[model samples]
Target: MKTMPVLNTIKKRLSAFALGVVDLVVRFKRTTEKMFLPWDKWVKPEGSIAREKLFSRFPRYLKEPAGSVRCGEGWYPLVWDLCTAIEAMEHLGMPRIGHFKAEERLGGLFVRVESGSFIVKELARDAEHRAAAICEECGEPGSLQLGHGFAKTLCQLHAAQRKPHKVKTVPIPENLATQRPKLLFLDTEFTDFDYPQLISIALVAESGESYYAELENGWSREGCSAFVVEKVLPQLTGGEFFQESGYAARRLREWLAGFGVPIRVVTDAPGYDWVLMLDLLHHELPPNLYPTPLNFYSESLPELRPLLKQAHDDACRDLSPHHALQDAEALREAWEVMKEHLHPAILRQYLKL
Candidate 1:
C-alpha cells in the first residue's frame, strides 16, 4: 500500500515536469512575446510563465468584456501588456478588470483586476514591473534611462524626439469670440458653516442629465446645519461616493464629459460650494481633463438661490430646497420662469457669464 502511494506521487511529479517542459518548448518556438497563445484569449509575455498557471488557479473566467483604461490613444501600444494580463486574469476566473490605468506618475502603469485572487494579484504585480521595460512612446523594447535631469522609460527614437523642443505660450486673443454657453446648474451640501466642508454634490444639465454623489469619507452630520443633516444626510447614505472618496467625483467628470467643454456650470453657493467642488476633484482629474472651474457671481447673482427659492415657494408645487439635484432643478425651473418675464440677454447679465 505504501509503495503504491509513493508511486502515485512520483507519477504526479513526472506529469507536472512534462507539462513544464512542453511550456518551455512552446516558448522556445515563439518569435515575439506579443503573439497570442494557441488559445486566442491570451497574449503571453516573452519569458513569463504566469499564463501557464492561470486556468488551474482560477477556473471561472468571465465571458463578458473587461474594460480598458483611457490613457489617451498615444499610449495604446504599451497598453497591450496590461490588456493581456487582464485577459489572463479573466481566464483565471476574474471577469472584470477593476482598474488598469496610467497614473500621473512618470513611469510604469497601474493594474487592478477584480478577482482579488492570489494569482491575479501576482499577475498585476509582475505587469507593474514589466511596464518600465516597455517603451512609453512607441511601445517597443525599452528601458529606464536618464538623459538630462529626468528619467523615463523610452526607446532611442522617442528619446531623440524629447530633445528640447521650443514651447510658446499663446496670449489671449484681442477679440474674444464667445459661444452661447450651455449651463448645467449645480449644487452641493456640506459640513459646517465656517469652512463649509463638502458632503454631497449634485448637478442637472439643461438636457435633463443629472449626477449626484456624496463624499464618502472624512465627513459627518455633526458641525453641519440642521437643514443639511435632515435633508442631505439621508440621501447621501446609499450614494456611490460613499463607496469610495473618488467614485462619485469620477462619475461627475464622466457626466460632464458628455457635455462638451467650455462647460459653463452654475452653482447656488459659488463662493463656498463651487470652490469645495473643485477642491474635491483636484486629485481625481488631470489638468487637461479638468473641467472649467466655475464661481457663483456673488455680486450680481447674490441671493440668487433665495430669490429662486422664494419664487419656487410661491408656486403651486414646491420642491424641497437644498438637496442638490432638486435645487438644480429648482434653478432650471426658476430660470425658465425668469426668462419668460425678462429677455435672456438681460438674464445673462444677472448670470454674469
Candidate 2:
C-alpha cells in the first residue's frame, strides 16, 4: 500500500514548516531574555570597556530582574579586565566583595571578598597585577605611568602631566647614512609535517611594506589542526599575485637587493621557518640577511618579556595574525615600546633604524 508521490511531498513540506515555526519561537524567546539583561553589552566584545564608574551606594551586585555586578573603583581599559575577572569569580562561586579599591602605589587592584571560595582571593590578586600593566583611563597599551615621583599605570596620552618621559634619539650612522636595519618579519605556512615543504611566505618590513606570495602548486597539507582550518584557511583566499615557486624565488632575491644592505629577519618559529625558507629560496638566504628568534636577545635583555607582553596588549592590531606581515608588525611594536630604555647608539646599531 504505497502512498501517492504528491501526498508524500506535501507531508514533508508540512514537517519542515512545523520545525521552522518552532525555531523562530526559540530564537524570539532568547532575544527577549537578552534584551532585559542590564549588562549584556559588556562582555560581548573582549576589549570594549563596560562601566566607567562604580555605584556609590549598596546592592553593588544587583539582584534578579536587573542582574549586574559593579566594580568598586577602576576606570577605562583596566576596568574591562577587572570586570572580566569578577565575572570569572561569579562563575567559580560568587564571593561577595566587601571592599574594592585601586592601589596605585602597589600597582594592584585590591578586592576584599567576604565569602565563598579561595579562588576569588586569587583572582583579586591577579586583577591587581593586571591593573598595574593597564592604564586606568584609555585602554591603549601603556605601562605603569609614574609622575611627580609617583607611579601609576597609564598610557602616555592619559598621563600627560607625568614626569618627563624619556625617548631615545639616534642619528643615522655616517658610513651607512641611507641604510637602516629594516626589520623583515617572516612567517610561512608549509606542506610537510616533519619536514617543511613551503606553501606560502610573507615578509613584512618596519615601514609596513609587505611582500606576500603563495606557490601556485603549493601542496595543501591534510590533517592540519583545527586552528589552521578555521583561522588560516579563510584568510588565504588566492590572488593573481601568487606565482610559481621558481619565479617567486628570483623575484624575492631581487627585492632583497633593493633594500641595499643588511636585512634583519625575525622568525618566532626559527627552526621550521628557516628550513622552509631555505627550501623555497633554492639554497640559502643572502649574506647580508640574518634570521633570529625573539629569544636571541633575551639573555642580555631580561626585561624583554614583560615589555613585549605589554606592547602586545597595548597594540590595536591593524592586520590579521598568522599572516607573515602582521606577526612581524607585532614584533616591531614590542621593540618600539622598549626602544627608549635602550641606549640610543646601541638601539640604532641593533635595529639599524
Query: Which model scores highest in lDDT?
Result: 1
User: For model 1, what is the error of residue 131's alpha carbon versus the real structure, in angstroms, after optimal superposition?
Assistant: 39
Candidate 2 wrongly placed segments (more than 4 Å): 1-180, 191-195, 291-297, 316-318, 345-353
lDDT of 1 at 210: 79
In order, the Cα lDDT scores of the candidates are: 0.54, 0.53
Q: Give the Cα error of residue 124 in candidate 1, in Å.
A: 38
Residue lDDT tens for model 2, 269-334: 655665566656765556555433323244444555576566655642655776554555666666
Candidate 1 collision pairs: none
Runs in model 1 deviating more than 4 A are: 1-177, 223-227, 235-241, 283-298, 301-309, 312-317, 351-353
Question: Candidate 1 on 96-146: residue-level lDDT in tens?
Answer: 645443431444556556655554455555556666776655557677655
**Candidate 1 CA-lDDT value:** 0.54
In candidate 2, residue 291 scores what lDDT? Answer: 37
